[model samples]
Target: MVYQGNDPKSNDNYRAVFGASSAPFVTLLEELPDEKRNLRYSLFCDNLFTSFHLLAHFKQLGYEVTDTMRENRIPKNCPIAMKKKNRGSRIFIRP
Candidate 1:
């Protein structure tokens, strides 16, 4: 499930995950009878999270995830780009 929260000091946008645990998702899932726990779900999260434990838990439960990263943890061969339309109408591919 997706819900919005805020940083206490700056009031920045924050998203919370509640799955297989928590009051709301638990309540919702509990209402559904005979539901299989093997079902897979996808989640997108920011790199602000330091631990991979939660994501590993999801993987153990057969779920898939696509995470956005703020850290330079990926390999060098990975393509990283920032689009700037104001620069030009040309397309340049760099290695």
Candidate 2:
């Protein structure tokens, strides 16, 4: 979905439906038809739309999510190694 920018009412509506912490990308997923939403599908998104909480939310709903996340988005206590340390190594960290 395209965000027109600065729509307080739309943001409020999304928050009401998806909760206060919901990102706009969550709204895109939530806007899917009920039938589509019920299907357990794998979704791919970019860092701009990815977050640990978002992944957890989708996982709870039986959907698979794969996306790149910003380093700062990683939980401080997560066990994943830093980029330089993990370079050239295969490290898979699941949310």
lDDT of 1 at 3: 37
Question: Tens digits of per-residue lDDT for model 1 on 10-86?
Answer: 21121244322222322333344455554665545555542244455556656566665433544456455534445
lDDT of 2 by residue, 1-95 (tens): 57555546456755555445446667666778999879988887787766777778788888887677778878999877667675545455454
Q: Give me the runs in candidate 1 sitting further than 4 Å from their true place.
A: 4-37, 72-95
Question: Which of the numbered candidates is closest to the native, going by highest lDDT?
Answer: 2
Could you tell me which residue pairs clash in candidate 2? none
lDDT of 1 at 79: 56
User: Against the unseen true structure, what C-alpha lDDT does each candidate score?
Assistant: 0.42, 0.70
8 Cα displacement, candidate 1 (Å): 17
Clashing pairs in 1: none
